[model samples]
Target: MSASTPIARSKSAALARILDNVPKGYHRYTCGTVAARKAEALAQKFHTLYGIGCSPAQRLIRKGKGLANVVLVMHWPVDAEKVEWLLLATDGKGLETETLRDVGDKQRLKWLGYELARHTNRAKVMWTWRRTKEEMTELHALIAMQANQHNTAAISETLERIARQPGFRGVRTQSWALCEAALQRGYDGPLPHLYFVQKTNHGERLALD
Candidate 1:
């Protein structure tokens, strides 16, 4: 495919975002046994050429399809927020990694599956299936704060800060979605920027392998 192709452009955009968010020397882990092996295999394939290494965990399935719903465990270096990825470098070969930085465009799509892995990064996972109670409570709080005409920047900042706290991570993402859903139900209140909100289309389902 040509470099200017649409798919190439999409991959380039996605790859840029992934590379930017994924810290140097940090790798990702895919949760679950089967998903983990797939991630490991992908990482092993390009480990010799690229230093990126993703590892897998020995857990069972949780949600989504195949690797889609497998929670991603990111392993961060000290001083960085921790996350995990699958496709681990073999023992003693810590240098070998599963990165897309230097991989070709064709090969890039293969690793895109990693994106489906359950991720804590707000940019990756938009809706949180866990912690619904906390999320709902926070959602109402944010709406109330917005009604009080809090500074949009402060409101956004608060959302970010709160989302990072234990038991509240991804609350911001879900908040936006919930607010949107509320609006659809004929509620009115000051709301944060609604640009990032996403919703599931009716009848859509994850393709099972």
Candidate 2:
């Protein structure tokens, strides 16, 4: 499906209207004395990269992801090259400044791949949870049972199986660990850091600083 379909158009139009009404070059708001700047930096970066103006409504949608309250609809050109260009531009700060050793790069790429895979699996798990909650519970219990029987290998195998199950798509073990670690550390917002850890043969962990 096209990214800028009718629904996307409506969302974009709403965001555009919000932006137009705001004072030029002023992108901050106050709910109380608690005032915070809008995501002007991110918006400006996006605009510079994609040649599209971003409005407060768009910023709200992005910020809402942290709150887990609102559904965001972002539109971009359907072409793969353009999509890559936008992503590359938006992601440049992380990829360029981050110092990743060879091993760390491999680990990070593995984690990224797993994350992508896990998104697909999550859909299945969600569908199963909705349609047959009891079955889903039992499935998880069975997997946990298998995981408990063995050591690290068993744990990894169990997780992989669960991930490969129909509807349980997306990244495997290390990715989940990274996500859990981030969440536990109070990363309730966008992924601000672009670092990953790699374990060495000497049982030491190296940070992709």
Error of 1 at 93 (Å): 22
Question: Which 10 successive residues of model 2 have the least lDDT summed?
Answer: 109-118
Question: For model 2, how many clashes?
Answer: 8
Tell me the tens digit of each residue's lDDT in model 1 across 1-209.
11110111222232333333333322333222234335334334433332332223321221112221111222222243322233322222233332323222222222332222134565754212223454467666675666466445545555445444322224345656655644554445355542321331111111211
Encode model 2's per-residue lDDT on 15-130: one tens digit a residue. 22222322232222111111123222333443443323334465456444531111111222223221111121121122332232221122222111121111234454211011
TM-score of 2: 0.20
Per lDDT, the best of the predicted structures is 1
The C-alpha local distance difference test score for the whole of candidate 2 amounts to 0.28
Worst 10 residues of 1 by lDDT: 1-10
Which residue pairs overlap in candidate 2's backbone? 114-171, 117-170, 117-171, 118-170, 118-171, 121-168, 121-169, 124-167
Superposed by TM-score, candidate 1 places the C-alpha of residue 48 at a distance from the truth, in angstroms, of 11
